[model samples]
Target: MSILKLKPSCKDYLWGGSRLIKEYGKEYEGEVLAETWELSCHPDGPSVIRNGAYAGKTLPEYISGEGRQVLGTHCRRFRDFPILTKFIDARDNLSIQVHPDNRYALKNEGQYGKTEMWYVMDAGKDAFLYYGFQREITKEEFAQRIREDTLLEVLNAVPVQKGDVLFIESGTIHAIGKDILIAEIQQNSNVTYRVYDYGRVGKDGKKRDLHIEKALAVTNRIPIVRKNSSYPHAADCDYFTVDKLNLDGRVMQKLSGKVSEESFASILILDGEGTISDEREELAYHKGDSFFLSAGSGTYTIEGSCDALVTTIREKAAQVRIGIDIGGADTRIGLVDVHQKLIAWKTVRTNAMRPAKEVIQEIGQTALSLLEEQGIAMEQCVGAGIGVPGTVDRKNGVVRYSNNIKWEDVDIAKEMGACLPIPIYIANDADCAALGEAAAGAGRGCEDVILFTLGTGVGGGVILDGSIYEGSGISGSELGHMVIVENGEPCTCGRRGCLEAYVSVPALIREALAAAGKELTPEEIFAAAKEDPVVKEVVDTYIRRLGTGIVNAVNIFRPRLVILGGRISEQGDVLIKPLEEQLRQGCFGGEKSGIPEIRTAVLGSHAGMIGAASLI
Candidate 1:
């Protein structure tokens, strides 16, 4: 695929605290309003439309398949093909605001709400960003503070630095400080509820409307903040995997094999200039350029000058286990007795392939039948839980994108509930596994836990204080999509050098095949690690990369534990010992520091199924 160049789209606002120009004339004030690029949805922001006869149309029209053939897939799925990338130059502090997820939006605004991230381009000395409340404040307290105009006292302000990336999950009260530039990536939704804006006036000399009720409704009491951090550099999951490569001078990066049984990838050039080459083509890239590569593209190479950061997003490996009769054909439902002591199970069913109406009907019938056989009635089911393999508006149960299932904008929960009459909870499967591990598996009893699944690809789940943390729209836990290696391997998510591209099952297989000049299953390669020095070397390299990736997670999350699951976890000691050692040696925290404990997942194969079921 050819590279797509995204143009700069800016916003000029007379926001009370803007960075406009100085006075130019007696009647005109050259004050700099907040100059912004609206990458996603912001009611007051600009939208990016495809160039052509319908060029002036909004992004929603393009995503809804109004005209262009190239955008039909995007419109149907509502995937995160970031439309309007922006450069925000804040002159004064913005408002302290939070966004609702799709669920909140459906319940109130009747649309999907935006969830965004900011990459700091520049900041003044002592400049800070508003993140969460200073401490855990109750909903009532937060409401009262906003009502009393004392909310500023409770906000947590973090010092800012250039190159710092902040992941603002939905519902976290945050704002940008003065003299800063940021690149924002978000959901294609335009609903924001401001709790406070420093009591500033607009160009019209009026305060903006405050959505106190709505803001309080969605604001998270316990907001997490990680400072002075970079990308994960390596991680995985079904949706996307990321790797952060800090390159200086020249570097050679290669990616081969597969991350999942089936998947694709993309590359995002965050900095510097570089070229990616495959057997068929060579492409040059500069800062902010992105490209997509098919999963079937096999091995490839990237050689670049100066320093470049690349991120690869791809599919996670399929989890496996033996089992007897469970249920459903598409569900991949099965139960296997383990060691006559344990039972492992998995279920991978989706309605993405069928018509939306049919998918809803099929899921409803199957769920009802499954529940009834288990002596549980539909009414007693509490809520139906689903694990999608792609980007999802979890709050509203909308499957935004799923290449594996070929689904887009399907309200699986709402539609199914219409027929089944039950509350429904949905999330990414990897996130489900993370929550499962936290609730009843290896991370049991821990307040904070980060679960990593090593399979064909990698997936992550974050649990805090016994509750799964779903960001705005329930689209938060995308650990695998963090960039690690600059201009490294290609990923499925249309980025390059993501974690999945490096240490995933397919990546390991690729390395092994490259060394032995023959293809081998991940299992066969592991078995050979004991006898073949070459295989051991390859396995060691993977463990080292995996360890570095874990270090990144540790630095960012500071969890109480890091649990590993999925098929690759079957390698056991071969993967764990080295991983633990490397993490200990390479991480930022010293021994006895608040660094998290790293362990193998005890839930094994049933993790996903149990996690999926627990989502209820």
Candidate 2:
């Protein structure tokens, strides 16, 4: 029922033809109409609504007036409209160009990089387009070839025909061939770095500028591996998924589909003469027609012969993932929803003295009870992620060892699977906590982070590119085992002067007891440090030694954030401020690479459970 016809914004680039204006029936007064932005909300060239109550309003304006719910829940991930669809008519070759990836583009251009797919509608004889490089080329050779005006020599040119499809990822150097009419579906971005323009001049009678420097930085000089279209989909990528729809008036005169609440549907009429009807109303359609159907628009049907492309945002449902944080005293089970919120939780006594299988069975039963109370079925849950307080062989879902709960060589997944009918994943408790913090805690929005938990022992985890970075052998993230001193103090891990030996809660208490002649809790020691010189020295020394370990981590990973967790981290700024100062002075880059932000973990006890669930 909620369908709106779109009026395209025409472009008159020098390389464009008049096909869009003549054959496609686009109304443009320009000498040549090269491109038509069909379904766009981009500020550069927005499509206008031609029918319905929002007539005469640009797509962006309509979206603003109607609220983002019209875009559907799946679009919640995007800051703006997710895609830009266009019809490109190239009478001459487009400039050879490359698009930066999201990281680089956001830093340099303040926009997402373009990853586009082109569906060829028509092509002239011998039509060919430059893809990536024909072979791997060095940066020196690429620059030399560009300067010598021979870059095309090393480029991979592919012959094109009607119905041919090409997916161009960011950093791929490419150019559209002459005499090709194509439909392009791309990310909502207009940033481009043109490398070669074939001596073309703009309308101002001046040579168009070339972005050779940026092109040199982002271009991928390797041959691109082409892939065939998978059945039922013409092109599929993170940004968009497109499927071709064809209806022959005699054999297949009708087509029907339903747009669900997850995503909106875009119907781009290429060669079609049909009537499209939804639950509320029906409208006639022809070639070059574009329609935007809001999410949950029930069923839609098209009748008469047609050739069209259907595009939809195919994002996974944001379902809950069960997280179980196994501890020595208690097992905390929680349901972390799509927003990484601990929507529901329960705690049960963990009788570690009992057999591992018995303990796991209790934990599993507790999780099932929690789900039942919340009205969540096993099918609705993404899966279960368990955080074991020990070495975990994640590949095999085995708790290799756990000194906290005295678990050894336990098949956690198999035991838990007996009660929960879903996939089970396991990881070191610290690693799980770090993953949780990275996703929704202190390191939220950061892809790389390092978390150090200063608890009974200084446990830590490395999260690189948003995943727990457990290196080869699965014992690699034992951060506390790294030695910072030769023989200063003995560690529980039987190592001398390991980071844990110097800065753990017990170590801090030991230092306080040695200096103050009395045992003090971490909180009391921090409070007494304000007036007591001896206690201040103990705390400063603790900070200094911990800073050494932190500096070592920052130097190695250069993560975007360093998170301090565990109970001792409750010191907040008192701990982070001094450590940050030490890290600024002692880190490898000496502040030139920019210091990673240091912060205390905010998730409290739920970090482990939420992080465990994130494993799914």
Candidate 3:
């Protein structure tokens, strides 16, 4: 049903009050009812589904049972459920603490970051709380205060009443005051760096440990001037957006809303009793109750006398990306959306003789034309990605060198950004092609992948854990340059016996010309190699060299997939079979370590463009 009511997980901390039992109808039989995790998916204290097809199940179980789409499109960007809601009844003041941002928390705590908003449901007459530093303080002074038990003097003490809102962003030191009941909407992360605990002993009769060093590293030791942002939102941050819902049963008995595919809706009822209904079913709700509505569930009505906080994810106008493929002769531009759909496409002739600035300008104009044709606004565009055929300084978005396009040390992204006015990402054409395969072609569903591109010259891309591996200094993954023979053949890279010298299409055609005494295309060479003994020897040597290279890559990276792309890949099983046998014979662990599956890329020529677009 639409209204999936939840049963909160209760905590019985030492400073908790029984107000949750006397007022909020909490059925907990513990010594204290400190906090109620009303809408939680964390493993430590998961909320239970009270009414639905998946009744009596944990929130995580319900999520798994209903597909991740239930969390909505915005949530899909997160690896786990994005938000957590809870009710806190603090009988005593909480310890002064701060939380880390995503980068710090993810590295140290192995979880997402915390940025929370608190709504004062009720508070004592003289209740007050710490907001942040009253004024700018030196790190040394802040540390000294904590050591001397004078931290409260530097903290900003603000008196609070019912219906007050305080946004506690990550790194802002804050604490809840005694005799305060609050409804908190926060990120899923539970990392907190406690600086002080008022010398209060825990159940084991020892003071709560202080993460002083960690707190110093993360805390914002400065006065916090709350911004009165008029975005028509209570808390409109990256993690979540919350809006207050005050319904009067006497006048308006029902509050209707629509949850689009963009975000799931959550209702945390703080007061009153009522029933939420939709086309599916009706659910009764009370104080301290929580309801989860899946995304794209269409229209729904909340019919009740209640005070609630409605939460949903706020998103950009669109998640579309601009993809550019800088080819030697023709450059292609495309617009790809979050759904991986190529919504708009265009192509322009590239005058390599023109200045790089003029050429880049023309490419940017072509992208705008595609958007106009599709009736898409530039504001809806996320970012732009360009794939250039050469070594690229991906970080600087500069094309270091491209033999195919005759470009060297060109700041492609900087020039394009002048017109596009969005973030620009640049990557090597081969790496982009490999990304395309991993995302939508043969390498899909695999994390680690190695792509061998055997065209005029052999080049490859190494993908580690779904991202391009540039190795040290953004100049690595030159797999085709690995020498397979001791001074056997000269290579374009000015090296002797390189794998590219033997396995590349140009190399094969040259070998066939020497043996068959006729210049021919790779296809014609392959056909002749099947009949002529002299041509067969050259073909066998080519395959054997390629097999050696493939085996070496497998043994080193141990990728889950090894894709063969370029013109040679068109042969499919003809090349894959012999390569597989050769790997089995020579590779140290191709079979025992589970030989990486060999597959031909499915996206073909468009792979470069598609992969570039995904950079957004």
Candidate 4:
């Protein structure tokens, strides 16, 4: 089946204080404003009705009767469907604003608060966006400024490129400047409290009411400036994470892993063009394209020649510390600790997969000392797990083949066990991720789970009945090798139409370069996806294919839960909704009731390490 399609409705201005004609050109003049295009709610948008005899009816109307039977209470608001889509055109700058948390919004606005990202469509040179205030301003100080019309003095104005993307958390004070168009994907709510505006008149020639009291109540005093370059810095927060991608040359970048349960990714291609390949399909993207890749145990790859931007979302932590030991070209080990709950150690060398004995020896000498200091004896340590970038025989603990690590048929677990006098586990990095989730993170407490990781190459892992499911000598669960399209694209696995052929990180980056007509990174592609529809189309196709693969997994396993991990998972709902929709449309079963609960993986990079530890 084809990907699920959402119908969008437009909103018209000329009412109350909302400006319409002036903000948008005559094409939107006297016409309805395009508020949202998805099947969810905006109060001003359209809804998706169930297909059948009542196909054209509103979702609400259909749900009131026969539709209720086909789609049960499992999805009262909407089954496997995303909640909303928002569109904004800044004629003049919007008032600096902020949204409250869900509880606060329900109490005050009788709706959900918005947590959203902006994908710039059209921007003038030197365009700007309001992210946070300049400094910590006391409520009294903000109140006085609001009364005197001097709020802009306290706000930070960051210049924007045409394809820039910025994440606006619930309490962030922000606004869009004039001559900019944005497609805003957010939670299903419209409870923005306007703190300040440029004193502009509406189409009705009346001043808009300022929500000074509410704005001051929710505004975060910390100042923030959206970075202007392709690769802007990232600031982790409890709600979400925002980062910029600037791709140059044929580069494949991996996100620095974090320890967090439930993360998502939003890839917005700011410029250039190329295709993002994953385990299942290939996504051709250009500018203004946004696609969501679920982060699980699977690794995905992207490739192209144009520049792009990518953003990842994951759990926030109090502190994240990393220990790096650069070992020339032999092997470099990186150790990461997050709030003491998670730890990840990685070894990279000029070769693809190191000899099992060599890896065991290095891990023992380097990481074991640190583990002992942490009260874990070499024997008390659960298991030592290793991830090679290439193929693996997880069941037999054999490194099948790794072009990067340069190893084949090496018994990793056996060799490690001999060295440490403890149980040792080994799998492809992606499979290790599946074990990680099952042992500690998102898939914890669930008997059956599936994980997909998005990176240079798509990787996958499955857990069934409380244990990692390695099929037929551990050759199974190679989800990245699955083919979603016939004769689609070439993959590193030496196969065409494989999932990695379309949705891998390298593939996504490549698509961004092609769109911009220059080389860039995944972060740059994300920025471009905000403003360029061509990029958006590429992302949309990628997202749809990703969803299709997920649906296929769901149909085959029908697991109780599905957790998305890795960097691509940072896209969050941008990828989740469409994928969920596809699953719903494809899955056939009894009662049309509760299927699998699909969520972002809670464990971030630590999943593999912890899972490996669990093996002890």
Candidate 5:
């Protein structure tokens, strides 16, 4: 395919200026041209393909027809189209607003959260915009200021000029001042929580409604340290990376770049006119032109006497993170790319008899072997996330002790780092599973969730605000040890009637066998319950005990959801259906508070591996 030129969709927002139409040559008959979506696949305003056999189709249609692989491997990380580009001409000050990060946005808005960067094209003298807070304020103080119409007093307003760059992370409070034209690159989400709209009435003659509560919940109420961010790129974020390209039509007549299969190239013309061509074909380019060159389109040459922003998703290998789940019996290692896809993996036995040094050495060697087998270079890896079954001193990347693997005071990160030149981060294995579930599995969009791994022993992780919250900065969240009964059955941790004693797979198996006067695996126990009354009682009691623990967790954390993982959870609806009933009846607030959505984890054993890889 040749270079795909895009015809932008126009927006006539209330705060729009006509600069886009008059100065930028955007053809729109409306009285005000607020923004031009030069590169977008959003249903609200998709860019139309302007040239080629698919000229009449919208960008989404083209992607649908050409297949998603045309977007390249890096884009696969996103659930939908990864980017949206726009030219905004702010005639009036935008509302003081904030945006939710990915977890919050996906749950509430059904889209990715917006993290945007702005490259100033033009700005009138004395123009200024709010960046964040001038100083940290209490939640009560913030609320009081907003209610008193004094919120702007605490906001940090900075003057702007042409060529200034500002990266607006999703939760940062910001507003664009009047008389400024900007080129914006952002995630595809369009959720904006307007905090303070300057009491301006819209064209409909009504004050814009304020999402003060949601804004307060998501806003970062601290002063942001401003920087130009010269990090070897124009802008860099989890979602996108951008570079500035300029040509004078004088000394530099042509610029060249290679479009590898790992990522496609998106070029937006800011000024001047020139032609962009490759091995496939050549196309004319001018200001306002947006071009999409498919990945692996090799040896692209831009004979452009123009200024442009060249954006591309970094290659998949470059972002691949390794997740290593160290189990007593066997260890699972997975290579997850930028999109959290486990593209390559390996399984090796845990040589528990070996010294800690040798075990760590093997883990590192196996990782390199997997990379070699998959044809990935070490330079392509971001780093590794290791999930060990133990208490860890995360501050120093030390494994204080692991009962499962019988290791103590091991600097696993250093051992692995020696074998592999990349950074090695270690965390509790159960925590890794929770993070994996939250990142890409059943818990993907939820912000706060509890993952119960119902394995040999019921270990789990607590994810709050997209992070593992370890209380007191060291030891806490030993969810399995929470006692549900007094002086009942002894637990592996020497506690009587703890949640793990009643709910873990081993405990269930022992009790089921004793009840039925016969042996059975968890799978067989569930199978026997259907026809045997004794086994049926065992299943019922197991569900009730597990429900007790779920109720306790829900009431304490009030998380949006709960995920059941590890071995016993794979029984599917057989175990979950009854547990849900128990939770419905046991939760404190009844129907008003609503029980969290409880679901079996989809990632299974790989959760530890994938979660570990994503820690970076």
Candidate 6:
């Protein structure tokens, strides 16, 4: 069908009010109408088609019968339906919670993460809600405050009014305050990591479970850097783009538009009554009405005064950069668009034991093969960046020294450039990760950022004033070599008490073996720390030492963001919370100077690849 009206699935949450039912005309048998899934394909609650031949069928069922084309060509990249629209009425404070990113949610929860926008429809006097943090806070302080029930003191309580629009990305800690109604459009996911519930109880008379560990893993512990609100469009991002429509009925009683093949259009009516019509069909829409217009439906017209949100998918660009992360064991290469989206990728084993020229040739050939498979031309590429695991003399395109790859004085760029058609650049793999994160991931929007890769060894990269701060010599910034202990553990760099000695994955496992008499994986060590005091001590010591190194880096560089990466970082909040505490205590000047936000690197394994691409 070209135009289909949707019936929402209602919810009777404990903190819900009746505003949606009384004011927005939502029909629900529940005593309290908390939320309405207006346009959704989520398994828990799906919107049903109310009119046309698809009436009584859920949105997913209709889409299945109509074929995927109904969703539009712009939606082809997605594995499932892309967006979910809802209406919520809060009579009391909702829980303080955080949503994970796609990588974290998909790995642990078997679903996509949420990135949502809230349009305030109505609010009571002095109505406010928690958005993020009032200021930068350490994971340690965040946990302490949660246990003390004082989290609200540090949260940024936004005083919202009707018509205000708030875009909440994944990882932002937020809650809806009492006496407010909101229209929310978000990714098609229901994953929420609730951190605090105001000690509230569920129907069973027990406090609702708080996902403290998970929340800590995902919550961005800093005030959101608000964007300029005077943009041409209402809200635009990778998932969906929404535009506001207003017709005064006097000066502009009618508006016309076309539903193109690129994207299907979703119309969420916020206020006023109107008649929406196409060439063959016309339907009356009131407040809270939801309508779906199939792609390529030709011209459509709307008459009568109305305020609405028109949402559609935005297609990605074809132009991309090639990123190559060269490790001793393997190399990961990918194509990343201007938006920093990784379009396609491939992993190839790196025979680093071979001569540098041969390895570079293989990597270059692999990149070319990937491009050919993706139907990409050399002209479409901006350039290629290579992340080498070693001391890289970027200016001369040489690998000065790399113990892992057993390469020294090798011309990586020159060798690779010979086989690839694009210009080539190279840097330390750790440095690439820092650059990638600062450019597009957790450290985006921050001028000064630091990244620590805590895997087999502690590796680091420093971005100061929007550029990598390579020291005066070709030795590069060996942040992991900085001494933390007076004469503690032996480091791989043949030093005593360097940060790497105590903070790396091997270091943690070593400590566990010494203290607990059993060797364990990083995941097992963290899990055991919850129950085994012996393992807890080992983990605590690791965090303490890790914090010491971070404190030293922060004092010297004064960065705004500190990112934790590498394999060990997968522990998430289990690793971050305690480490943040030590940094808070040991950091010079403490809160007097703004504390840098400590976060887990969101780019994961692709950080090196994306970071390498940023060199272009």
The local lDDT score (0 to 100) that residue 15 gets in candidate 1 is: 45
Tens digit of lDDT per residue, candidate 5, span 535-603?
Answer: 999999998988899889889988888999988999988878887888889888977997888999999
What are the Cα lDDT values of the candidates?
Answer: 0.61, 0.88, 0.85, 0.58, 0.85, 0.87
Model 4, range 306-423, lDDT digits (tens) per residue?
4433434333233322222212244433333332345445554533244556655665556545554554422223234455556677656687876665666777666654444333
For residue 551, model 2's alpha carbon misses the true position, in angstroms, by: 46
Query: Residues 24-93, candidate 2, lDDT per residue (tens digit)?
Result: 8998998788899999998788999988889999989888888778887766556568899999999999
Off by over 4 Å in 3: 228-231, 316-453, 456-510, 516-616
Model 5 Cα shift for residue 77 (angstroms)? 1.5
Poorly placed runs, candidate 6 (over 4 Å) = 228-230, 317-616
Model 4 stretches astray by more than 4 angstroms: 1-356, 394-396, 590-593
**Order of models, best lDDT first:** 2, 6, 5, 3, 1, 4
Looking at model 2, the pairs that clash are: none
Q: Residues 1-616, candidate 6, lDDT per residue (tens digit)?
A: 6999999999999999888888888888777999999999989999999998999999999989988789888775565788999999999999999999765674477567789999899899999999999999999999999999999899999999999889999999999999898999999989999999988999999999999999988899989977659377788877889999999889999999999998999999999998999999999999889999998887999999999999999874565788999888989999988888888999988887788788888887788778779887543565688888878898878999999899999987777756663457888999988999999899989989999999888889999888778888775688888988888888899879888888888888888999989889999998999999888889888887788888889989999989999888888888788777777787788888878879999888888888999877
User: Once model 3 is optimally superposed onto the true structure by TM-score, how far is the C-alpha of residue 143 displaced, in angstroms?
Assistant: 0.9
Better of 2 and 4 by lDDT: 2
- Best candidate per TM-score, number? 3
**Ten residues in a row with the worst lDDT in model 3?**
103-112
TM-score of every model? 0.45, 0.57, 0.61, 0.43, 0.56, 0.55
User: How would you encode candidate 1's per-residue C-alpha lDDT over 1-616 as one tens digit per residue?
Assistant: 2222222234555442333223111111434545544333344554544334435554444434532233322121222332333446676677788988555674466545555667676689989989887889998898888889888888888888887777676688898887776655555556789888777777678988888888878888895765445335433222223444544543444433232213333454555676766666676666554444433455556666423223333321322111111122255322212122213233435445467678566655555444445443221233445666777787777988866667788887788666454446677777767766776678777879888777767778887776677766547677776778898889777899888887788888899999878889889988898899998888888887778778888887778888888788877777777777776777676676765677788876556555665554
| Top candidate, metric lDDT | 2
**Model 6 — which ten-residue stretch has the worst lDDT?**
414-423
Selected candidate, larger TM-score, 4 vs 5: 5
